[model samples]
Every structure is written in C-alpha cells, then in structure tokens.
Target: MFKIIDLNTLGLGQEFPENIYFVLRGWMDSNNIIIKGDPNVIIDTSYCKSEKETESIFSFCGMKPDDLDMIVNTHNHADHTGGNNKLQLLSGAKIAMHEYDAHYVNLWDESGLNLDFSDWELPKFSVDNILTDGDILSFPPFDFKVIHSPGHSGGNIVLYDSKYEPLLSGETILNGDFGSVHCFREGNRALFDLRDSIKRLAQLPIRLILPAHGGPITNPQKCIDDCLRRINILIKEPIKMGYHFIRRWFIHAVLIRGEMEREKLFSHVSEIENFYAINKRYIKINNKDLFNEIVDDFIERGVLVDRDNRLSVINP
Candidate 1:
C-alpha cells in the first residue's frame, strides 16, 4: 500500500524514517524522493506546472528548495526536469543529468505534442556533473553506481543506491510497466538500446526499484524481465500503421478524448473513424492490447482522464 506525506513551509524532516521522503504528485501519484545525505539530494522534480505547487515537494523532504545540494534528473522529460530552475534558484543546488539527454533538458522543442513542456518555460541549469553506467557516487551514508538504461531516453540514468540496495530509476521501470519509449520516435535504435539496458540491469544484484512514477518494486529482476518481454513483443509485432498513427492516437484518443464511462468508451471505440485504420491494423496482430495497456498506464499516471465513460487529458 502507498501513503501520502504532507509538508510544512520549512519542511518536516525526520518524518520519514532515515530522512527519506517520497514527494508525490496528487494528479497521478507520480513520486520522487529526497535522500538526506551529507548534503541532501533530490531524485527528480515534479512537472513544472507551477512554482508554488512544485516547490511544496521540498517541504515534504524536510527541507526547503534552497536546502538541496544536488538535483539529479534521470532523463530530460519536462516532468522530471520541470521544476529544475525554481529548485536551483531556491536551493542553489547543482543539476545533473545523463550527457546524452542534456540537450533535451537544455532546449525543449515545442513541435511535438509532449505535454511535459506545456504551461511552463524551460528552466536553465548548469550540468555540474554527468552520470554513466558503472559510475558510483560515494556520498556519505549513501553509495550507488549509475546504471545507464537508454530505452526510455538515450541518456536515462538509474541510481543504484547500495546502502539500501534500492535504485532511483527516473522513468526506466515503473511498477511492472515500462517508461515511455515512444518519446524517442526519431530513432528506433533507442528501442533496442532500452532492451539492452534492462537486460544489463537484470544481471545486477538489485533489490528495490524506485521510480519517478507509480509504485516501487521489491523484486528488481522480475520487474526488469516483465518489461523486457513487453519490449520484445513490441519489436516483433512491428507498428504496422507507422509511427504517426501511434503518436496521434496517444495524443487524441488517450490525451484529448474527454472522459466518459470506461465501458462506454470501450464499447463505442470502433465508431471513432479517425482511429479506425490504426485500430484495425493493431487488432490484426493482437497488438491492440498493447495500445490499450499504454493508455491505461497513462490514465493511472493522471496524464490521461476517464470521466464517466469519456476520456481526455488533464490540464496541467
């Protein structure tokens, strides 16, 4: 079971055992944690929806935004890096992200309907450090190596904290479902990269898997294997309708298609002519399940809405 932690203005340190606090977003329950170390470190920041809301996460960590010494981003998605500028200004902490994903973090292009960038301007921050696979951070009371898991994004980094045998995985592994791999549609190579990255981590002696979204897992290898199987299946099936259809469907049917009763949406889905072609193609290969699964995952994240039987995207 999951629990929610509320915060005061300055912060409620020691509320979480060992000074570890989960900063969760109420929308979808997507959470990031603050590890109070020699100098406290934040795993990731919530979407840059607004400063007032985002900064509250710091208080939950038992510290203010300015108290953080380091801010680590697992990838470049806006949700993970949105509050970066605000946090930096308050905490004066150095921001770190995988070198490969730094460009997206630095410059967010709006051509794509990626909602992570909606309602907020890209914050500026210096990459005080870079993390690569096998690189270990030995900050007192916590020591972990960086595992480069590139399927979700080219530069995705999962911090393996040995002290607790836990991983601070940004978007790599989330409660048995995988992170959004379609974000890197420009290169199919990233899909394969993600497979390899998961396989590599499966070999490690990991215990708990912590993610920026969803719940955590006590069994790392099993979760990795499940994600691997899903990726493998997607590869063999081939997205027959092409990437454009898949992207549009995600944005429309899943995001903008206002909420209704779940049963109503499912029953009447066949009537939506705009998605007929893609749906038919997926149905042929039994890939329709995958499409629905992704939609359900987003719904769980509060990124997708299902009201009554209608569906739509939640306005950030």
Candidate 2:
C-alpha cells in the first residue's frame, strides 16, 4: 500500500515570500497570492464559501476586495478561479487568464472548469484580458513573466518574477507532489502533458517555488525532479495513479472535516467516480471501490486510523 501523506504534514505554515501577501488557505482552497502594487493583482483567490469570508481574507492582508485591480488565474480550477466574479465585482478588477483556459471560464462551463467535483458553487466570472506565454505583467512593485505550464490543467500557469521570487506555480508543483489529474477531463493526456511541463520548469535557475497549496518550495529543482518522477510512475502504473487521486481526495476531505463516517464517505465518493476515474480507453476504475481499498490499506499502514466506524488521519 502506498502511504497516504497529509498536506499539512508536508508543511503548510512557516513560509513568508517577500514578493507576495501569501494567504495560506485551508478547506480545499488554493493558496492565494496577492501582489499589493499600484495595479494590486490577486492570483488564485481560492474557494471562499461566502463574500464576507473573501472580504475578510483581503482585510487580513490589510486591504479590501475593492482594492484589487486585476485578478489573474493560474488555471481554470474552481479553487483558483472561484472568487474571480466576487472580487471583480467588488474591485472592478479586470480578470486575466490564459487564453486557452479562459474559454471555459468565459463560458462558465462547470464541467470544463472541473467545478463538477466541487461541493461549493463558483459564481460565473468573465475574463477581460487573455494572457499568453511570455506575457510580462509590469506592476508598480514587480514584473511577472507569465509561463504557461499546462499539465495540472489546461492553461495552468507559473508566474515567474525573474528579478525576485522565481515562480508562483499554481497547483503545478507542490512540496513532494503535483496536482491531481482528471481523466474525465483530459484523459491520459494530462499525465503526458504534466511530465513535459515539469521538464521545462526544471531547467529554470529556480531557488523558490510558491505553490498554490502546502508551502513555498526552497529546493525547487529537487521538487521539480520529484514531480517528474511521480508523473513517470503514474504513466507506468495507471492503477497506482488512480490510487494517488483517491488517496489525495480522501486525505483532503478528512483534513477539512476532521473525520467522516466510513460508509458515508464511501457513498459520497461513489457519487463522483466518473469525474476523476473514468476515461473509457485511458482510465477506467470504480473510484468507490478503489477508495474503500485505499482506506483499508491506509489503516493497515498506520497512515489513518479507524474509530467507531469513522475514518481520520492518524495524527492530522
């Protein structure tokens, strides 16, 4: 059984990047990046269940939602793009996203945006400017070169600040792992694409990589190398890839909710098998069964512990 690792344990706190007002998020939220500048750009506002919460998040960073001038999305994921509409409406900020990924956001297509997996609804947000690779965003504080790193999702990007921090790799490369792929969305193409993206980013002279989750990566090259290794493993062992997806989902779910009734979690998991585990020719697995099997394995390996028919991470 592959050991299930908790994101919190992988190191979430203790990171303070100078170029950003990093809002480390909990509850399946992407780590939000706020660049307080003349233009005041906010990348990946994360999943705020309410506007008040969103406003509070900005307030904590000593700003209001209306202070933002631009909303730059790293990808089309709900966690990354969820707060675009609310923030834009409040601040009148023009939203910018990769032209390739903007199509789904512009259309507000939940399925295409992969919002179908989210329990919370993301309000429709439109893009005002379409970004391409090599686009330079010059704000008063700093300039960021948009690097289109499409692998985790179509149009996923890494904002590279050459003069300062290297990259804001949104869901592209976390500490010891990368983002999960939805076979239902891109089939096996996602894995192949992810491998290529990691290869390209690995060549950069990077010392810091601020990911959308977990924390900032100090040894970026090693992390990038690890990401490539994981991608290769997934491509070679497809069923193990399915295990990876379900394992992360359950860990995140339990992390957010503390614990859940085993049967209830399994039933809910069964409801969304096709979202991450179905691609007739490429990926085919009943996530419900896989999820159950993963749980037993986790318990056996002490990654998780079962109590009163409820499941939770051992020390999370």
Every model: Cα RMSD to truth: 7.4, 5.5
Q: What is the lDDT of residue 26 in candidate 1?
A: 39
Query: Pairing residues by index, what is the TM-score of model 1?
Result: 0.70
Model 2 is weakest, by summed lDDT over 10 consecutive residues, at: 1-10
Local error of candidate 2 at 57, Å? 3.0
Runs with alpha carbons beyond 4 Å of true place in candidate 1: 1-17, 26-30, 107-121, 124-126, 183-186, 240-316
lDDT, model 2, position 253 = 58
Local accuracy of candidate 2 as per-residue lDDT tens digits, 181-220: 7654676588888888888887776757878887667788
Candidate 1 on 1-316: residue-level lDDT in tens?
1244332221322222456665655332236777776778877776555456766656655677777898888876665776778888887898888777765545544423243322233455556677777887765566768888887767888887655566777767776756655533426676688788778777766666677776556667788888878777777765632343354345544332346556555545544432444445443433456457656776787776766545677732
The list of candidate 2 runs beyond 4 A from truth reads 1-19, 117-120, 252-260, 274-276, 279-288, 297-307, 311-316
Residue 306 lDDT (model 1): 66
lDDT of candidates 1 onward, in order? 0.62, 0.73
Task: Report clash pairs, candidate 2.
Answer: none
Quote the lDDT for 20 in model 2.
59
Q: Which candidate number maximizes lDDT?
A: 2
